[model samples]
Target chain A: MIKSVAIQGVKGSFHHIVSQQFFDENVNLIECLTFDRVVEALITKECDAAIMALENSIAGSIIPNYALIDNYNLHVVGEHYLDIQHNLMALPGQTIIDIKEVYSHPMALLQCKEFFKNHPHIKLVEDKDTAEVADRIHKNKLKGVGAIASVLAANIFNLDVLAHSIQTIKHNETRFAIVKRTNSEVAKEAINKASVKFEANHKRGSLAAILNVMSDCKLSLTKIQSLPIIDTPWKYAFFVDVTFETYADFDKAKSLIKIMAEGFKVLGEYKNAKL
Target chain B: MIKSVAIQGVKGSFHHIVSQQFFDENVNLIECLTFDRVVEALITKECDAAIMALENSIAGSIIPNYALIDNYNLHVVGEHYLDIQHNLMALPGQTIIDIKEVYSHPMALLQCKEFFKNHPHIKLVEDKDTAEVADRIHKNKLKGVGAIASVLAANIFNLDVLAHSIQTIKHNETRFAIVKRTNSEVAKEAINKASVKFEANHKRGSLAAILNVMSDCKLSLTKIQSLPIIDTPWKYAFFVDVTFETYADFDKAKSLIKIMAEGFKVLGEYKNAKL
Candidate 1:
């Protein structure tokens, strides 16, 4: 299928990279400047689907993205994990010695802090987007300014890599979710994973009871996040992701959770991406 | 004893208002520009203690603050829920019609969207700080500019409130946690609540088993947040907030949870703030 995938940030961004790596090369790309806009594009049916970076292995969960999914009633159709490589890039002629200031998202800068520590002369400035900085450096011919982004960004913007994999941790990765508007969820024969959300009172054992159902059904609990319910004070809505070996096991778990939990909603049911 | 409290943002910010309402008025206020700085002040003993907004009723959990408390090994001594009222204020004489731009934090702007919908002429702009915008408007004597901040801000900045409690939700509240360096958690005889974090395997139903232990101990689970363990990609550390009627019940639950959960650590044990 020729899918039109919406992603936050411009071309050569991590979302863009994920689109290329996860989907067919012939797919049309719709670039969004904000995660909210990406959600808007999907909800309004402006794009077939959207890719959202849920959490960086190093930086932690993008909480707002979770809220966006829940608020917009989006369905998580699939998931992908991409290894993050933050490369220091600038104009073709620029080198480590030539650059005076470095610009990237605060998180990208934070990941590459140890590298920057060795070179104290280069001032670090936090910007909104990593690829945006790379694009700016390329377009504005901004010399003495470096951007920390992906190698793909360097290739796309026609910039030279002053340093490769400059992030402090080499094993940094980000989990991206392929989400479609809730109305567009198509059922498939082979499904082994599900994401569900529920709200409950602060009973002594209610949450534990819900999890026990998942256990009995042989579902592997991968992730659970608690989001405070906006209107209800001191109450929370829990988002849980579970994986199972068989479709029967997942269906049993889903039905059990739905019966046991309040305001239960299944976000998505698809094949486990990690496999 | 005289107390020194650290709060994020300038004077008259929401955090400052929380500090005043939550603590003794004699506290020496240490104003911090960022939550990181507030955490630093608590960790380094620059202040006797600190107040950090953990979550909002509308916008949801301040997940990063949970990371800060866990990473810094800080102790949560108390908590306070502040009813947030976002006010639109400008130069004393200028009315709503005269104002051109309304600036506040993105969340504040969002909360007041219904009010802004009525006043289509006012352009909503995202700013770094709410009180800071009020401070700027006052400092510069800017007539056409307005800020969405607290009543305290309007008073501190010498501005007139054009609209009061303009948030879409009338009962908006933010939960703030009182944290101190680990040294301050002296034995309290009447402890009723505790915040603990535990790391565990992703085995099917393993987390449920741990929760069962808590249920058996009669501890009421108020909140549970799963934060990504940065160094270990898929593994998560769950931060659970539980309240109990008796310290004995909590101690029993804590001990059992320790045996079942990996890397278990008590973040704090304190008197239940809600009670």
Candidate 2:
């Protein structure tokens, strides 16, 4: 069992909240300022696992996380989707009408573009973290500044939630994965999901050939995304996650894909999370 | 002859530099604040053509432009790659050592993360346009704030270039495409190039089958990128640009690809730009 998890940002950050949902509440928490540092800590064994949010339903995929996952060779042990409820938080006794400025991460600001558009007079300030914005407002006693953050941030920072779920998209949820240094053991009880990253030759149809091998193996693909190979212009390597009924032809599938692909690496195998 | 081209942002922006390279310096300039406005100007016949930077060599693909190209129905008439040279600009006598704040577009700031890391004391500010940062500094006569912008911005704003080519990567060339409302008549006279966007069924081997059609047709693909369909999670549609030595089997290639793929749209047949 994982005893500790390191996440980027402060206590009230979405990563912190998501980490709590996956691990024991008393688990040791290592806070880092950046996502890269959290991944580094896990790779260096400073933490048992690292939890990072990869995508928001409203904001789309966090593309940088895709690169980090591929670069660090970390295995995604499990994933959970947290329904994101963005709240406008301010120091205690402050009201929404009192806000002269609103602060949050740039992406959070963008996600709340509709709110800003409606309240055009409020100056939108970009900060490093959403929870940090609330913490600053509370610590600095900024009467005119509010933060767009989670309800948990408001509670932790002793701020009042002025508005709830102000995000333009009502179904906003962020998908986070728990990444560990080692891959999970393949279970014999039931078929599990697997993820792999592969590079295809620059030639046309290279990616298609790999997909054909999966089809031939009777695997059901869940998700596939392409991230540019940084060194190569106009070339991309694909990351794919697939589900299998059993581990019966898994090795054969892997070999066939290797024959069709220029390079491939199995990221991890885990029981598919229940939505 | 093409008389004028529309582009996004103010003069000294990367788009402006690319447009100047594609069209002569004497061409009329139509500046818009956003990419969508540039496309609208071309589609509405307000401009003869428009140039938009679609990707930076280091920043991967500009995913938003891909969606705009597909939705706007503009024909890509030419392509150009411009080497990006970012400069730290400030009022005439300001030096990098004296700077307390730096401002640029978020993307530009991200490209220079290493530089920012070294100058940790400098507060980084995000602005809508890099050139605008120069303009603001010039107008405000701010002593300690600097802007990361083009050399043209420094010249136009009468600011000094404190540092040159501060990007993380040395060869930071940005790829741009010229789009027009009408197809180029010179397309057939020059080397044939084809652009297509397609969606594959959410099944394994679907994308490969479509690519096989292109390989079978002997077309060389120049660029391929996947943009999230946005409305769906973990689903993407791909856009591909292919070059052909001759137009002999182009129609057959399209038909074969269309049969194998879902929602295929041929953007246009255009001659590759000499630059």
Query: Per-prediction DockQ scores?
Result: 0.53, 0.41
Encode model 1's per-residue lDDT on B1-275: one tens digit a residue.
Answer: 43899898888899999888877888999988778889888778789889899887665667678888888888888888888999999999999999999888877887788889888998988777899999999989998999999999999999999999999779877888889885335465767888889987778878888898899989888888676666564677888889888888987877787788889998888877674
Best by DockQ: 1
Q: Could you give candidate 2's per-residue lDDT for residues A1-275 as a string of tens digits?
A: 77889998888988889888877899888988888899888988999999888765444456677678877888887787788778888988887778899989987887787877877778988888889988888888889899999888888889999888988777776778888988764465554677788886556666666777788887766666665565575466777777776777666789888877766888777777743
TM-score of chain A of each: 0.94, 0.90
**True-vs-predicted CA distance for residue A213, candidate 2, Å:** 1.9
* Model 2: DockQ score: 0.41
For each candidate, what TM-score against the reference?
A: 0.89, 0.88
State the lDDT at A69 in candidate 2: 80
CA lDDT of A143 in candidate 1? 97
lDDT of 2 by residue, B199-250 (tens): 8645666666676678778776666655545557546577787877678767
The whole-model lDDT of each prediction reads 0.84, 0.79
Window of ten residues with lowest summed lDDT in model 1 chain A: A182-191
